[model samples]
Target: MSDTQPPRVDAEASTTADSANAPRPPRLGGLPLVGSTLSIARDPFGFLETARETGDVVAYDAYGTESALVFDPEVVESVLVSRADAFRKGEFETDFGELIAPSGVAFTEGERWRRQRQLLQSSFTPARIRSYAEVMVDEAATLVDGWDDGETISLREELSRYSLRVLARSLFDLPLEDDRTATVIRAANAVNRYASPRRLAIGGLLPSWFPDRVEREYEDAMADLETLVADLVAQRRAADATGDDLLSLLARAEYPDGSRLAPEAVRDQLITFLFAGHETTATTLTVACWLLGGDDAVRAELERELAAVCGDRDPTVGKLGDLAYTEAVVREALRLYPPATGVYREPTSDVVLGGYRVPAGTTLQLSVYGIQRDERWWNEPATFRPERWLASGTGTEDGGWTLEDDSDRPEYAYFPFGGGPRHCLGMRFAMTELQLALATIVRRVEFDPVADALEPSLGVTIDPGPAAVRVRPRREK
Candidate 1:
């Protein structure tokens, strides 16, 4: 279970390993070395379809390593939550640990991850996130102010800018005054494109001695990100201030041993927050806008809720709870296109999942994408229905919403922000950011899709495809 020990099976050995001795799972039959990689590369949904055809528990080879693609929610739960200690973040994440930065929650494991999580948990508490709402609302207003009525724009691009501004102000205590915001936005997109699965799979196959282009791109992006974070940290350190900002909290944070985080640790966490916090929230907001535009009923419902709660004033943390339909739209969007897409784990010991005995060291992929839409749990799996979330009486009785019942749903089926002790540290911050951005956008403008059909494309996060929307300012009544 030690982090330093490599898995027993080498990448090449996994390619030729016999399933007869090892537990055999259903598998797609096509090519020898590259099984379903083309289908997965072309369309991730299609790859899931192939996985379904094979069965809930299907086997596949990626980068010369055999992996089990577990689509069953219960089985996914076993790996992610119920028996989480039996699993570790798979080799794919480990290979890019340095690329993710050196010391934040994502790159660390075991005691290090636990210690960091403990120290950072207070920063993302619901109350703390609520305090950050004004920052989000202010930034959102700025974003909407720049848009003209009846003008066509990419929702994805706009939300990216908006979320980056929110993250910059809330997390780093830095205003999105000029080129800094643009640089962060560019770096995030560059990192996303470079970390696409197609590139990662190819890079995973290459030897450690080789320089991966994608890796280099990721490093360059991280370097820019580090410079921004380091400058911020140094400034805060010189001022000796403990301001009500995430960076200040981090800068002043002390370990149980009374030691401050090293500069590299600060840089790593800043990068983690930037990548994990903004990008996913931005994507969710963009998809929410697209869904609202495409469906008249949903848009009307959202507008009604927003008008009722917000009235003529901008949304504050107190007002956010009143936007029920807005929250519903966000929930449905996440269910349909979870930003994390999938949770990955590797078994520490032989374990039986979905009636198959997977050996120790087997890499496992828990498909949040597949399980969220699985017919077994949802009535109309493919439809955009926020009512389903309401039926369980878990979200909110009044206009105000809470996540009480979200956990009551089948475990891994609802991981927009992952699960277990290793769940995203900034979940509350991201949610607050999304809620404010979404409510402000709805209040200022009506949106309509420019494309006939909008599709979710798989990237580092699930992204909307080839879709621009026309935005119009709401008429004064």
Candidate 2:
């Protein structure tokens, strides 16, 4: 295969509609109009699994809306990278625009997105990330200190607090009070709980003006979130202080024309980071710890790497390269349960996908969850196996610490951090934080989870459902 040739996988889609002008992908769902929206919104992961069984590319009626779900890697490439110019952030993201605003980088596109990305790029560079590692390590160690040996802890809540604290410290340069941090965590979880796809779909069936408790709760959380940041920004402005945190970075940031982000825009960006960076990384850490808790061999191997690389000291960027197996374990956990369930984008103009001609403006849902779990792409797709990443040997040269490139695996198959130009900008920092936290925590404590099936509790990000771990110190301090 030529390097430029977009590598094709054994993925195919069933056509839903046949037309000389636009051939549709296969359809998956129930009766017309409402379609599969209810089923999908009720259990998103299960819905996607069923959709994939129907075809690699399948069309479904989501409430009054219609969308094509892309499970094939080639189609994902076309949508995210190849034909990226022809597509921009679409309906699904726009649905949450009120939460982050169009000015926020996550929801913006075109020139605005470019400028926003450029303005924010410096905050996530190698040097910038290295600077943030100390905050991450300190937060991880602090979390460790709180855990007593043989104490049963709720992984999700504790990790949520830890991740929020890290973001609060590293990005904002302010410490979150215990009460305030608890409020933040509670509000975030409330938003996720009520913002399910089913709720949105059901709500859509009603008038636009109809009251939505979950939506209201999510808004309340967002309001609390905005107030929290606004207060911090106000304090920073009053104090005339700008430290090394991302808040400091943005407050002091200037465009080429020497203009600064407006106050509201600054708040939007802060909330974006809080939403995008905090909960997702928290989910990653929580799930990683849970996954390791179940597998003794994996934990032993990771502990060995931690002892060899970090010894009794906290982990930092300088020691990341030595935490190969630890990082691989993170990647594998993400593959098994990606935080972001699906990716959505729309075509700017007409494009053909999966041998079916698709008209412009058709909303497409690229199932990241389904793609990563497809048996065709992974061996024992359902099992938690971190070693597959090591065997790939694609990124071990960096000691498996860097994000694994698409050299060994299909590019779109495992895009937990996303791909193309719009891929996550915080990838490096998130990876760093996860590796450091995993190393720091595992080095000091081992987790023994209570026996349970542990179904994924779906929310803004997937969480390990209701599983508590017994934290036991592995070695003397």
Candidate 3:
């Protein structure tokens, strides 16, 4: 499963006796029984930032679960990379049976995850993504075409819909009609809400077999989504479909021993891509726009680059290589509010992290949010400076963006996309789309934030909430 999958939180986990004598990480105090639930939910970004200062690896009790939150790059690397085999993704993997699709890559482990990753990896290659770029530009342009100058719009909501449509056209090779869009939205909304930390806290306390209200809602939404995906697959097969989109690629793929993905397997992957593919990019884009909207100098530089490189035309694939500044803006936005706030991993056996023992059943959360913002890895950590991504050696020379220079930095310090084998499959696709869409929209509209500061809605993704903006088309030269 992609790291973008809502972390499957295990509130019931406890460390073993083997780790009893290990140096304890500082704990953030919280209310009785409920622990730090309310505080974390109220301001996750703020909480993590403050918590990281307590120590790189700090313990926190949220919703009755004792978790060690890792913020240091070396420690984050240990969990996500070096000792990866010693840990498995927590509750979401062993639990959440049919709650999510039945056994997709995001939740699978060991050899199962390997097989699925290998099979799916072929469809997202650089060449395949290049072939898919036109669909991205067209979908983005279509969304921009619908906006009005000087009109206030929720960039989050609009881009959420746009990214969903882009996923359909670019990878799925389908354009969502109104009804289809509604179904997907319903499924996505329910899944995100039901999987939220608040919901997980409550749901984890109850017996697994108990039919809860949110579980019923999730099942209903999944039912609609599964039916839609199944029908699409069946329709393709009945017509002897021939195409190069991801759906068709998966439809025609085989197992090493001359077997095809099970009917349910196809459904699982389709649901994963459709549900996960759009939300992260949309969140990143909304946050990026808001950041740029509030900064004239950054926006002007971005505008200047767009004008110089794209020049009176929509951005084509070849021109994107010159859009270094625009790409940096997206990267900086991601650093501030990564699509996945934290990743959850549980050690199967006792492991040493930051000189502390994480015994079996103890859950470890790598706080991507805290690490990205922590000054240990950044210069002026809290600043929204896209120039952090630029260096002297690489430049367009015509005053466009210089190449990003972070050769001195550690990779784990700013991994908006989680690292190691389970890194996001859609990383390149999402990056390409973000740059094109941002360029397409900013080439015309300039955003002015409606409020002094936007607040984050830490749902399935850390969305920029309901922040609206007034967009006016830039005057023609």
Candidate 4:
């Protein structure tokens, strides 16, 4: 499976075909004027689950615009992979593009996106990622050491700061100054709060001139973010862009035509990484800890695996392959609580999805959240079972557990970082970071969840709202 191409599905014809005569999808009943806007904002998980029950492809009105929520893996493949060019970013992307990374790889299309991806790909390669393992382990250790035994802490806040620290050191070659750390945290939270489904819907309905509190905070955050980025860029430039960090690489990299990213373009890419890189990984770590806290058996097995592979020493890049159980834990957590809840696309023209004709410009919300948890694909959809991702070793020298070949399920069924050419550039970086961080932290401290239940909020990423855990130091054997 090439990184640029998405996995092909068996039902390619029906998914990619433009069937003009195909009937419109079954409508998901909603309110008269506001349609499903209020319902979706109030309970996106429930609303999407209801949409799933309606059909593989269900239609509904959001405000005045008609939208489709796609559940079938084949249809998702068509939109994200096979006939991807037939679709563009959904309506929300317009908001993101203007406010976030307008010229960055995330929002750019066609040639510009490709060029930026090419330049950025070098920093995320497996070899390059491995080089950052020590930093990841060291940071995780620092984070764990900060917790007093029996102290309760908010996993989201602690992990978010840890992720930001790692990103700054590993990629930017900039140490997060103590005074600026709070600014980064506030800015990140402001952007995420503004991106909530409810706020987005309200912002869309209201006029641009409307003085909304959320948008106001977001704009102020962006201003602070701009200042932060300018300082970092200036620091890097003064050092002559000679470091091995991502910022240095982008500064010194050039296109085939001998052109380099302008200063503003570099800033855009920096912001893209800051917003996209830190939050998603932080949420994932938080959820992984939450899941581990509730499942003693699974957590014990994970700790055992860490002890066997990593021993008394910290996790290293070379031992990552042997930490199969640790990796599976991460995989299971992602399946249950994917940070990227859904992907949105709009058709460039009329297209058939599961035999339903969707009109041009109709927003298609690929339900990653619903599909990953669908009972049809998973045996026990709501359960946290890391064993599902492991297989008895076939060819390893030690015959230890290895990652299961995912032939039993659809390729898109467990895409935590999305798929196709637009798949996350930092997939390897993120996995390496999570696996190392989880192993490093778990080996030293045991977590007992303080929160009763995870109330997943639909934010920029799926937020495990207000979840806390009590940390107890593990007595050395």
Candidate No. with top TM-score: 4
Tens digits of per-residue lDDT, candidate 1, 342-459, equal 7778877666666565777777877788888887777788899876665354433234443234445566667777777787777778777778888887888878788887777785
Q: How much lDDT does candidate 1 score?
A: 0.73
Per-model TM-score, in order, reads 0.87, 0.89, 0.89, 0.93
CA-RMSD of model 2? 4.8
lDDT of each: 0.73, 0.75, 0.78, 0.81
By TM-score rank, best first, the candidates go: 4, 2, 3, 1
- Which lDDT value does model 1 have at 163? 83
When 2 and 4 are scored with lDDT, the better candidate is 4
Tens-digit lDDT track of model 3 for 1-477? 112222222212323453564655667788888787777766666677667767766777765667778877877787788767778887644454356665777877788778888888877899988888888888878887788877899888889888999888878788888688778878877887787766876675689888798878888988898888888887776766567677876666566466777777778888888877888898899999999999998888888888788878988778888999989999999998898888778888766566565656667878888788877679898899988898855445355667665877878998888888788899999999999889988886788898888888664367678679988877554
Poorest 10 consecutive residues by lDDT, candidate 2:
1-10
Q: Of 3 and 4, which scores higher on TM-score?
A: 4
Q: Write the per-residue lDDT of candidate 2 for residues 390-420, one digit (tens) a residue.
A: 6453433223333344465677888888789
Q: Please identify model 4 stretches exceeding 4 Å from their true place.
A: 1-11, 14-18, 205-211, 392-399, 475-477
Model 1 residue 18 lDDT score: 37
**Model 3 alpha-carbon miss at residue 157, Å:** 1.6
> Which segments of candidate 1 are over 4 A away from where they belong?
1-23, 201-219, 392-411, 475-477
After the best TM-score superposition of candidate 2, give how far the Cα of residue 51 lies from its true spot, in angstroms: 0.9
Off by over 4 Å in 2: 1-22, 206-212, 242-244, 392-408, 475-477
Could you tell me which 10 consecutive residues in candidate 4 have the lowest summed lDDT?
A: 1-10
